[model samples]
Target: MRARLRAPRGLVPSLPAFAWLCAFFLVPAGMVAVFSLGESAYFGTSPVDLSAPSLDRYGEAASETFRIVFVNTLQIAVVGTVLCVLLAVPMAYLITTRLTGFWKYAAIAAVVIPYWMPFLLRTYSWRILLGDHGPLAEGLGVTGGFGIVDTLSGAQLGVVYNYLPLAVLPIAVALDRLDPALRQAGRDLGASSWRVFWQVTLPAARPGIVGAALLVFIPLMGDYVTPAVLGGVQASVVGSLVSSSFLESQDWALGAAAAVLLILLVLAVLAAAALALALGRLVLRAVRPLDLAARLRPRTGTARPARVSGDAWGLLLRGYGVLMVLFLWAPILTILVYSFNDGRTLPVWGGASTRWYAAIPDNAVLMQSIGVSLRVAALSTLVAIVVGTLAGTALARAGRPIRWSLLGLLLVVFVTPEIVTSIGLLLMYVAAGPALSDGTLRLVIAHAVISTAIVAFVVQARLSSLDPRLSDAAADLGATPAGAFRRVILPLAAPAVLAAAVLASTASLDDVVASSMLGNVGTTTLPVYIYSTLRNGMRGDAAAASVLMMLGTALAVVVLAWVMQRRGQGKSFAAGLVGR
Candidate 1:
């Protein structure tokens, strides 16, 4: 008898994610690349015409104006990333080493709270705070306020605040994972506290630092919200340029070319970072022996006075931690307080009242947008969880080639600027014509594509830590592969799966880039609605809506934390939230 054909071990399970990404991500991105080579059709039904393709758009993308915008974008990203690292390192170090029990989790929750809130809302809060008559201005005693609003300084501050949590969480996880014995060993060998931290602790946390940098820089490069809301015309970056090229100018070819350049810039930065890291490693290896000898040598002289006592140092760290917490929550609290404003506009306070909260029910358009956001988030999250779980589980058990290949693809998906993804999906939908006309469906697909990589990473990290024998044991008991997976693997991975679900949902709900590009009048997500409102001028009702969204997100975060704690996985929850 002929032997029945058999599928590869991990291929079947990984197919769902692979197929979805190829169709939604790869195909759309390819379309964008094709559009970049074509010319814009000014009066044609389509924005681009590929009848005679050339490299003209790319040359235009490299012109003087674009060069200035690109330089500004890089400067903001580099500076913001450095600030995030500077702030996050000490805070994360203190949290891991000093805080305990309730305070530790509370501190972490503080960071996660702002991160969980909608991105557009967070940026818009800064807009309110920096307004001429806003609280910061009033408190600083600047008559018409410090001229931060609609300027580069305002944009830079927003960038640092918005991406700070992304930098903190990963570093915190890395510092938390460090072995305390390594630091103790250094101290016992005549090394000072500072030396121990520099030689032992910091080097060990390199992965986290690198992770945080990538997390901050990649998205910051694509962030138009902060620049648009805070910087306005003077600080237009490459991201805003790409956005306007399509949305306002109707120049799809130029937009696509600019997006391609943006991606190249990101990749070049990453490549340079990798090279620097490699060179640093080589230098470290060369000097490692001398460093070891110095550490091993006995001290001949009397020790100098301690620079600061342990108590003083601890107090300083605690004080810094308090400041960090305040910085994270300031914008959110501002929104909550101003949501009760009796005034028509958000910037000026006109006494405390609940009219905006009361008016929420009467605001039909806002309510409809809220409903759309909820529906799209729910549906996209469901799809992401299913596809990501299957893909992640298979990845944990797959062969080396398949695992690496898929991981690389997922990393690209994760690191690709959101604006690029939005443009690609928009272009794809436009190419598909009327067949994909449902706005909500487009939003769901776009959101799912973004969230799936995150879910898959989280799930894979969770599953990789489990023993391989669990499923094997189940199989030995005469269970089928499917039965073994359901009975043993699924239950074991539940916490991670649940955590991934929460992340995926929150990401979808908080999304602005894809929602704005893919949504229409009837399908406007709450973030897109708030963005438009803020662009026109912030209203009290929008502030109220932001508060409600923040509370909803906080509730979800609390529930997830409680459930994970019940499972004795509390320590890993934050890392899981960030897919570390």
Candidate 2:
């Protein structure tokens, strides 16, 4: 007798996503790896040589000039990551613990909603704010002596500003899951409030803190945009070096080698972190007996409260939070105000007028770029939602090994630097001949590669929080697998999926490096347009373009919120979004 069996649902649905990734993401990456081995083509016009490859490019990449660039990049990324962690941890703790009700929700929304604005616009806004004639420089009477723009300090400021959300969200999630009873227990046992925090709280949040650090550190190491826009040539990092190698020098091999080296450096950092954790676990095991004894004898029956009163601390923290909010928005506010300035110069705000905004409609190039950006964003978001949701579902339901493999691939995409991927995608497009020279399809493919990972991560987070028993119950009732998914699981996952789609769209819209490298004439997106305007000394026009870009992406975020609210998951989704 033949046995009756039902095929698995998730893996089957997951095939399309897997294939898409292999074709678009993995192929481009593999091509780059292959390119790293070959000799440089003359002006990058001749066909690539596929002969026996050597480590010639690697040796060149390790030259003294490049070594200094690597060290500088490391120092900046480390400093920026440390600053972000210090700022984010305390702020996230305060929001989770001290704030309540409406204030708590409002606080998170304030931090999150600003991020919906394209990062390119935010960086551009910073450029104007920190320029020699800009507010900060003039106000401090250091217009020429010392300022952020075109300097390493300025680049670090941009890094911290851009990646702050990444550091905060993970730590916030960890804090949300933290049990208040643990802290209370420490206090009742005669430990000071600081001691309770040091012993009971920070350790519990270590994983999230580490994750946040990785998130900030990885991107900072490979960042080209912040340095390009704010730091200028003097503050060039490894990312700028890679771009110069490929585009300016037209040395494909050297650029590929530099990209590979950057990836290795990131991997090294991850390995060091893993080793440190292992060593920490061993040390903890060795000191376990001493720790237990110390705990047993520590009771003084004289528990001291925190140094500052709770109300005073809350007030201070709340004030600091407001200041941070202002700091984050200051550049954006500057851009918005200056967009309507009735003058040619950017830094000197002329009398308020809407001439710049009016000029936008008349600029054919600007309008065309806007149209291209919208279509690309829309198409990329659609692809990301479908592929990412399927991949996320498969990972959630698949066997342990399969799940882990999928997770590794997703993380690889997440942590890989944008410049590296941008160059890689550029090379792949170049290799595809005249048929693939058009930028639109290549741009969408490049964006979908990264955006899909983001969507999958969001969906996976939602799925992890759900109970498998709900699906099992449906199966127990004789409902078909597809029927159960459509009737039960889909409703639950819809809010997160929609939110992910919005995020994906925003990411696609905000992209700079990938689109810039892959794009040719007549294919410019808004970010590419803004970059060109800046390069060509059209700051006023860039500001106007930026405002429009911000409005579009911000609208998507508003829609995301509405979707969550309509699905009756508003509060829960907000918590998840804030990394609770």
Candidate 3:
């Protein structure tokens, strides 16, 4: 049967995506890993490093600041993961297993829509909505009291709000796949709902939760916006530390070391999570007893389901969900509203005018930054989508060796922190010895490595549902292997490939950490420029910048969503796009 099975076509369905990943992921990651071991000079600005094997930077990471930031990064990651999981699980449960009918799809769509928005917009919106004197405080009538506008709480909110959907969707999918009958069986055997949940639900959902935690934790550890805006100086996470080191303080060695430590920390956490889960499962299996066909079956009685009456608790959940949604959106709203401001209070609607927006075309650096960012994002996205798609398709069609090599390459980027990734890219660029000194090319290469990893996973998921039969049927009708692929596979997978391309583009567009470190002076991205504008006190120009970036991202999301909806197979893929 296996031998008789016709071969599938060009893998073109995933070709663009696969090619994007390949160009971006494997090549860039390889470049970065090489650089991490190399040396960086003049704060990350000079050039790359082409040196012999060494651990000097890794050893230098032993400083107190590195230790503090490392610990803090881990703390943020752990706490953020826990918080997102707690909130996401309940929300996902209620939305998925619990609720049905009209609100179900709408609820999922609500979460979906915001995720598609630009992430920087999402971060900035929180700052606006959560500001101490803003409507969030006033609405709750906090009463001349405080708010989390600039506190760690605000940072936490930023992390959770941006990532909640990321955490929720994966777990919801896992929980949705659970056998409902498992719960019923436990109930029929006299187990309480809570007991059944603890035994049946949590266990099955564990992998998904672990996946969610890994997804959230890894990114949180490397994130810069949440900390920069919400955290301010009150407990700067590792990402902020790395950015400061390279961009502000010129502490390249320390930054490199810290980046290296972060990579190690990520590995340790992954191992620990895996090991802990394994042990937990083992312990649960050993101790957990079967219902054992309880001695006397209870008289059958219709089970009264736990009801959510949509009262205060329901209202609270709905309100929190809405607030979270607004938190994700309101900054863009504020930015939009304030782009018209004459340069006054941000959260409030000061006088309106288009002066700021009009004046933007005159601000050369800002415009230059915009140009540089778009160029970088565009190239990076192209590279990522192509490389990512390539890896995905190859993995599907490849032999074991090819698959392993491809995955191993993706993992390098997946595990490497942005700080480390940047430092590595710079050092390696220098090490390449002036041949690849063009900053734009370096940025593209750097982005490809990291983004290709994500593209691969997404493309792979899309490929799972693909019907090989389509390709096989084409091939049997005299179509060549390549022709079959071009005719059948490419068209079917076009939606996923396109979606991945947009995703990679947007992520490249918003990134600051790596861009700050590796982007040459003239090539700073939008986030870098906005950070610069913030020093002038988040003014109208800055607001305008925020608005511009927000609109750009929002436009991308809309296009992507439209593309996804047209495909009709985009529900899952759309949900996965909450954050980069």
Among these predictions, the greatest TM-score belongs to 1
Q: Compared with the true structure, what per-residue lDDT tens digits does model 1 show for residues 269-304?
A: 999999999999999888775564375444678674
Clash-forming residue pairs, model 1: none
TM for every model, in the order presented, reads 0.96, 0.93, 0.82
Q: Global CA lDDT of candidate 1, please?
A: 0.87
lDDT of 3 by residue, 1-580 (tens): 4677643333443455445445444454456445446566554444335456476666666666466666667777789999989878766666666667667766776666566555665677666565555656768876543656566777777888778777877787788778888778876787655656666787778877877887788888888677677777665777776677666876655565566567778899889988987898789778766453441233368664564443655676666666655654565566566567653655565566787777787888888888887898788888777667767766665556666666676666677667666665665665576687787898887777677877777776666667757766996899977786567766666766776776787778767777777777678777777766654446566567756675666676677677677768566445445321
Q: How large is the C-alpha RMSD of every model relative to the true structure?
A: 1.8, 2.5, 5.0
Model 1 segments more than 4 A misplaced: 1-5, 290-306, 567-575, 578-580
By descending lDDT, how would the candidates be arranged?
A: 1, 2, 3
Residue 508 of candidate 3: its Cα lDDT?
A: 81
lDDT of each: 0.87, 0.79, 0.68
Identify the leading candidate in terms of lDDT.
1
